[model samples]
Target: MLEDKNQEKTSLSELGEFGLIKHLTKHFSSYHKTTIKSVGDDAAVIDSSEKQTIVTTDLLIEGVHFDLSYMPLKHLGYKAVMVNLSDVYAMNAEAEQITVSIAISNRFPLEALEELYAGIQLACNTYNVDLIGGDTTSSTKGMLLSITAIGKANKEDVIYRSGAKPTDLVVVSGDLGGAYLGLQVLEREKQVFQVNPENQPDLDNYTYIIERQLKPEARKDIPELLKELDVKPTSMIDISDGLSSEIMHICTQSKTGCKLYEEKLPLDPQVISTCEEFEIDATMVALSGGEDYELLFTISIDDYDKIKGNPNLSVIGHITEENQGMNLVTRANQEIELKAQGWNSFKG
Candidate 1:
């Protein structure tokens, strides 16, 4: 008789794409009554019932997406939900529900999972979103989280990246680059801890910036504010992938160009001071640092007057014809072409 080989292990890389998908979806079955179609198709079709539905998803991986050593499971859970909701807001829609799935290893304790759920529940309550359903599984490696957020919007009110036109004013909400600088502070402190276990982190001066990194809030109010002002964004995207990269995305999709002014870029005082302390260039940080979670949008020139004086909004540039290309003008009056050094997970 042949020996039993049921205990043999297989590598994920050996299975490749199709085999991996099969392995993952093997035990998953459609449980929702509204699910018209589930996996095995190019796209999953759902019953819309004449209502426009918005879909967004986010992926969080260990080490790359977060550092478990300093990041509490609760904050990690809250941030996972907030990041996807930010995308819904970018679409000018109201987020109503989310489905969360997690893959974890045996190293995590049951209490840790509970702490993570607590944070997720807090965010759901705060945003008034329903945690519809999800899947839990064992991972061969580290923790991985994926969230899919579903939102609703009227067909007429939906905003897309293709609506921007030349001469429209470019605007941004809140400040920029604080989160990236905060990460720098945290990493520096972590290094110190590794070198000397007895040394306590000097975090008093970096409280504001550090919070910006660990706990970023989505700009859910921007959509309501635009409605109150009787203005709709011609084009918009959240600033998760650095200011310059997001601006390029809007310009590319809208078939337009832009001229952003350095003097007009908003920076919090704490961000500037932190950059100075770390001996890093503030301008570079403002332009290329990611995870700000602010809104970058464009509006018709006529509507500029309504938003110009708004404390939460700042006009940083203006849209131009495609031939003009995207450029940034420095405070010294020199113009330079903008290039995006946004996060590339594969590269690093």
Candidate 2:
């Protein structure tokens, strides 16, 4: 599926780097007034004002971060943007722009790159972000994408991971475990297809989870919702890594312990059912399932009333004194020490 001989393929060398950049980014329009200049310049410029500027970048290597066998190029482009935007949103800021740099192998056709940029354009249009300056080059192997998201917030509004205090409530937006299970399903289908090339995967039942893996949306609305509710998070981090790993980052930086209740961790119906079918522990899946792109943050105990009934938010736990240590209080009435077991790319 990666290579389509029947489809019209134009060699990337035909356009060259500069031509390719112009051709792909021709349709991208600047949505942010802060963007003074976009592509086709010495460097893109932004007229940032009084708001604090937040910048975050992520590098995605082909085989290390993604597998193209089951992942679509369009989804890859969109997911790459989401990967960076999530970080900006974690700071409780509004994402306004992104710069995408890519290094591609010769195997990719210009049309394939077009498909890739089409996804990026869709994300920019949907998220109201502008495409700034980026570099293009050849690669030795597969694709590598590095996206830098730029955002802004008022001086008093930016949140950090080190500001969580004792008794602050730990909150997460959206559910967990779907992206990991989605990857599991896609990997399983890939294996089956490798064994039997004619096999057609029936993924009707796995649509939600599969999309969760392939086309995750950054939590751009959470910051807005918090502001509307008149609540501000004391400490915040995006759930790119996993619930356990992210909370550990918050606690370790904030110098406080946490106790996440297993029963309180949000899980969608499909996630719960898929976990049962896979014969895997759902709790561990939620704890270590990376790439969910949800926002996890801590807020003062006094603000609980503001967010209590919000469907988009879940109060999973609360901060504790550092002496108590980070733990997961299980539904079985057991307390287990939490570890950073989620999404270690260097793991053997």
Candidate 3:
């Protein structure tokens, strides 16, 4: 019946606000014990027990954060959830629930919303989280999504950006720069399509990078892996605003200095090749290209033995005394001050 409704074209006024909310969120089921009550109430209820609750929110505007021309509604929904979940993971916590509110224009049909919600449901199912509650209202412009993700962790286990001390080893999970290059590819293809509508882009060579941009997955396993290894990170943050900016955040908050090794920065082959093809520096891309969603953390140097040679982890640098300042050691051993060049929504 729901699938049939998704196939039919219906107006927002036909269902009204409450009717649309019920229709969209009817399929969500709770999996977390912390979710005491989900939806259908004046307010969603949660039982944090003795754990410390961590809440993070992010806003995604249609034209600013994403370009709808190339971004599918389903992917957009999935990415929105992933972006918020990544913040929770960065704090070394388990995300239990999320509230997804959207203001969409009437230009979007019911079927379009169903497609977006389908992606949201897929993300919730994959992450074992509950869609507790949200709001749906009319928009005069395009669309906007505001997601608030709630998570929990014991007080001792909750990591923060201010926890790092000098001599800690810096580490990152997976790779970097792929997402930014992916956007470049998509934009290039979009422009080409505009000039020649009949042309078909051969995207086989750009598969990995494109997926990185369109369907990035949060690093949900890094915290679990650290627990298994019995290694606690001194400071941690997700790579949303590029490596340089994230590194600066940790340094500034922790009141420490850092020396990032350019040679140690990890890069996928696709990212490297794409950088060469685009005539851009791969190091610069890794430093300032955001949205990798990988975890950037600092660990006690003594724990190095446990993570050494781990395929999923990379030891890229080390923390230093405050006076040392933030510097990047180039492959040729040139020391250059690291700059914060990550994404700035205000500038746009």
Listed per candidate, the RMSD to the true structure in angstroms reads: 7.0, 11.2, 11.4
What is the TM-score (0 to 1) of candidate 2? 0.86
For model 3 the TM-score comes to: 0.86
The global Cα lDDT (0 to 1) of model 1 is 0.85
C-alpha lDDT (0 to 100) for residue 123 of candidate 1:
88
* Candidate 2 deviant stretches above 4 angstroms: 1-49
TM-score of each: 0.87, 0.86, 0.86
Residue 160, candidate 3: alpha-carbon lDDT:
78
Better of 1 and 3 by lDDT: 3
Q: Model 2, range 56-133, lDDT digits (tens) per residue?
A: 778899998999998899999999999888988887778888999999999999998998999999999999999998
lDDT of 1 by residue, 1-348 (tens): 455565576655556443476689999888776564344321133446655577788889998889988888998998898888888888888889999999999999889899899989998999999999999999998898999988877767767766899999999999999889988988888889899989988788888878878888888999999999999999888888799988888898789999999999999999989888889988889899988888889999999878878989999999999999999999999999999876655443
- 1 or 2, greater by lDDT: 2
lDDT score of residue 49 within candidate 3: 75
Candidate 3 residue-wise lDDT, 20-69, digit = tens:
76799999999998765454321233556778677887889998899988
Q: How many angstroms is residue 8 displaced in model 1 relative to the true structure, after the best TM-score fit?
A: 33
Q: Model 3 clash pairs?
A: none
User: Which stretches in model 3 have alpha-carbon errors above 4 Å?
Assistant: 1-49
